[model samples]
Target: MKIYTLEELQEQDVKDVIQIEIDWSMAYYGKEEIYKLSQEISKCFNLDYLIINLKGNSIGNEYLGLLAQNITKCTKIYNLELILEWNSIWNQGIQKFGAQIQKLTNLINLSLDLRINSIRKEGALYLGQAISHFSKLQNLELFLGNNFVREGAVMLLLEIRKCQDIQRLALEFNLNSIDDNDLQQFGQNILNFKNLKEFSLDLKQNYELTSMAQSKLVNQIQKCQKLTCLKFCFENIDQDEEVYQQILNSLYKIKRLTFFQLSI
Candidate 1:
């Protein structure tokens, strides 16, 4: 069943749900309401697919942090999407949520949106290490934009190297404090995944942009032989189309990925 609000969720039985979407995005529920709603969701032990949207709630870690602590009972969920953008989740909160999520070892497709939060390097490392344990994960979407991940972005990429079965991957690292050296490190190991058919990398508005950095990154991306769909996002380019051609040329020369899009 698909419910859109807290009121709708209160009317249903959580125990029998296998696929549920409770999107309370942009809600203004206070602490009591949030707590009560999470308590009900924690009872969804049989849930296999869950999409809980509470973005822009401004309640910080109280949103996912509450659900993380209470929802660890669901040990067999295969697909989960936790959308909590603009919620101000910090280091401890992400670390805790990451630990709790690690318990769900059956996840195949997972989407985690923690955009515009205050996550730093240590938190990012812990979160990455936790996700790297998902040996069954095939598709992963991790959005950490507008934060201060810095070298933590590289650390996350390194940990994700363990998800060798991931076929479709989309990562948003925009406006994080990631530097040139970190990008190079991420690019170095980008081709280790052998099953990638689709990939999206968003790194817009990063600290600095240089020709050598972009070139090195694309060099590794071009080596992905099975990619039929590839997207790249970056900003502050002096010549947009020029950069696009340089990357596009590298891909077209591959003769396998005729279906590709480059977003500048």
Candidate 2:
């Protein structure tokens, strides 16, 4: 494991380093303090990826959102993985600090968690729209069961398809009102990604509807000659073993395949 103490981080001037991680598990030093920390870190590292963790419950999301805004100013930041829990305060924080989230155009990968039960669907749509503006974003992970708009998510995927730079996608859906047609359309959009290599779908409670959704999905996915890794989880397996074996055998022959997983 890689560990850096605050004192150690303060002393090392790794100006050419491409990755940095900051863990704020201590007390809430507020936005200015966090901004100072971000500036210091940015000065020391020419970063391509950054992992920021607000470890303790000492601060609300507003402070963290402010911190994120400052960090986006780092010119070398291209990938960001943020781990945060949603609270009403944090939701308010993002709403108050609107454009900062949308300004991160260099970002290609982002991971975040929102408290689904509390956030309005409109809030999720706004965030989705913000993400769509990322010209280079290829991978996104959001943790909120039913808080996001089904069409917005699909729209984001369609938008990313237009970017033609996206290669990996992961989506998590709670018990939302999405049917086979939605899946079919989403699958069709994914096939348009000529360079796409990996896809993952996490649907919590739609097993019985998946097999009905499977044939179209599998067919569309198979059209991607460049795809190598696939992660799928569905509720039903109405197809027989022999037929599945045939499909698997043909899929294994794809030129880019090195990893494959299908769960029913």
Candidate 3:
């Protein structure tokens, strides 16, 4: 993995760069600098994979929007990852970022680590809408743990239902305000991805999910015929041994699942 700073990237002309990891976690740049860097990346037409690490950065809406706007110019990028954990990104910034994300139709694998951000329902909704536009996406990993998510969970599930080609999905929503209804909806929506082979969910610290909801979700998951691997973590959920066994039994029905992991 080659690491590049924004200054170094601006001076060189990148060509046929299949993979890039930009570490901007410690660097602070103004909007003009961000825009210039974006233009430089946009010229790398052969870039197939990109990772932007902004962890611990104080980036807000303007920086995120500028980054997204410039990154979307690379129409051939197949895999994209963004590490924005602990940033100051809010709903307005997410909205602008989402708008640019919708233009990247060639993405096959997408990973986003936005945990501890200031995202709310509106920001989550915008992200959901943007994800629905990825017609070619197959693998997705999203980490939004500790954000202010409520209705956003439902919006995300609804939009996820539109991605018919998704094969592997991992979602983390720990410490959010999601409830039984949200899980129920999410469970039902899981059936939409007929091609899904691996599924992982982390709902630890989400106190609203109860035994009843867990049972319902397990029932829905059993309907996934193509799943080969499954991992579920519900560390803080209030549930008894019987309920946990019932969920395990439900997983037993998936004959295709070669690997199964559960934590309660």
**Best of the candidates, lDDT:** 3
The numbered model that scores best in TM-score is 3
Better of 1 and 2 by lDDT: 1
Model 3 CA deviation exceeding 4 Å by range: 26-33
- Clashes counted in candidate 3 amount to 0
What is candidate 1's lDDT per residue for 8-114, written digit by digit as tens? 65676867767778777887767577667777767777878878887887766645666776665777688989888888789888877887788888999999998
Which lDDT values do the candidates have, in the order given? 0.79, 0.63, 0.86
Between candidates 1 and 3, name the one with more favorable TM-score. 3
- The candidate, 1 or 2, that scores higher on TM-score is 1
155: Cα error in model 1, Å: 0.5
Candidate 2: regions farther than 4 A off: 1-18, 24-45, 55-61, 86-98, 113-121, 138-143, 146-148, 174-177, 207-210, 235-255
- What is the C-alpha local distance difference test score of candidate 2? 0.63
